[model samples]
Target: MKACIITIGNEILKGRTVNTNAAHIGKFLTSRGYEVERGITVKDNLDEIKWAIDESFGKYDIIVTSGGLGPTFDDMTVEGVSRALGLELVEDRETLEILSKRYKELSAELTPERLKLAYIPAGSHAIRNPVGAAPGIWISGGKSSILVLPGVPREMEAILDQADSLINKNDRFYYEATERLAGVMESAMAPIVNRIMEEHAGEVYVKTHPLKSETRNPEIDVEVSAYADSAEMAEQAVRDTIREILAEARRMGKK
Candidate 1:
């Protein structure tokens, strides 16, 4: 399955907060066999959020959004998503009950700000948050599914863990492999890598990372990753690319 991630917050845009949510979500989706297409961070503007949501619809099977689920004025993900989906914003009693119970357990009153957590787009279901007040929103779109999770890392992870059934039920797993070739320079191998990429085309990706080690000479790590319907096909594709690159490296006078 192809997926995209949108992180909504002005703090992230301003570099005031580290955007760890994208990396975490990317890793989670990758492990689930989802092909992550891209990750974007947008300000907490409803229009910008809605635009992103709309643009991603039909282009991806799943779109996950993090942040902007709090009770603060700048938390506008729900509103932006609702506008994008043409859904009316309404108070969900079930969510209200969940919030109310949690607050009562802590001997705190559910103030208006806290009550904001109870509102969601109509027809969407709330994914209970075991770690925080704002429950995640799960909305089924025309062609794509959306999961709006809280910005808090711990709470976001908890919600995702609880969503295994949904994610697995909708996605198909693909195989991917990575390899790092030592004692090579990326520039020297560029011609062969380019040829391999063109030869493989959509079947796989061959990338090079230049690295240095104090104890050894500068080297290039070549990572070959492929995605296919079957694990064997994916692994074999990567192995073939690795062999081809290594042969070219040897031909170019590498010992």
Candidate 2:
């Protein structure tokens, strides 16, 4: 399945907030054999968010969005999604009760702004946020599904974990392996990397990232990920690719 992640926040674009949510979601979904086609960070504008959702529906099988699910004025993710899908925005009774109970537990007021958290797209299945006021949402139509989670890291993690069954319904069982070379440069290994990509096209994904370290003259981390019918086959493919790359390094007089 192909996936698209939308991180809705102007802070992300301005470099004020790092988009760790996209990284986590990408890794989690890819492990289940979903190829993450794109990660987009959009401003908190309603039109922009709606445009992103509408565009994703046409191209991706699974669309996951994080952020813009707060009580503040800037929180407009739900509205954008509703407008994009032509769904009605209505207050969900269950979600309202959940939010009310949460606020009462903390001896806080269920203010008008806070009550706004209960509103969602008319037909969406509300997902409980174990750690926060806003609830996540899940909606499926035909062959596509969209999961909207909170911007908070802990809340997003909890909601995703809780809804694992729904997200992983189409299990594909993918695997990835990483090997770190203590004294290798990414530039020096480009040719070998290209050769590996050509030889194992569509069977394996090989990427090299250069790392700086005080203990080693140069370091390059090679990550190989592959999807196969069995875990053993996937693991062996990555191991074989790593071994081949290392052998090439040794032949070039790099220990």
lDDT for model 2 comes to 0.87
Task: Report how far residue 251 has shifted in candidate 2, in Å.
Answer: 2.0
Screening candidate 1 with a backbone cut-off below 3 angstroms (N, C-alpha, C), the clashing residue pairs are: none
Cα deviation at 240, candidate 1, in Å, is: 2.8
Q: Against the true structure, what is each candidate's TM-score?
A: 0.90, 0.91
Model 1 lDDT-worst window of ten: 169-178
Stretch of 10 with least lDDT, candidate 2:
168-177
lDDT of 1 by residue, 125-148 (tens): 898898788999888756999999
Best by lDDT: 2
Residues 96-157 of candidate 2 have per-residue lDDT tens digits of 98888888989999998898889888878899888888899998765579999999999999
Q: Which stretches of candidate 2 lie over 4 Å from their true place?
A: 104-109, 213-216
How does candidate 1 score on lDDT? 0.85
Candidate 1 stretches with Cα past 4 Å from truth are 169-171, 213-217
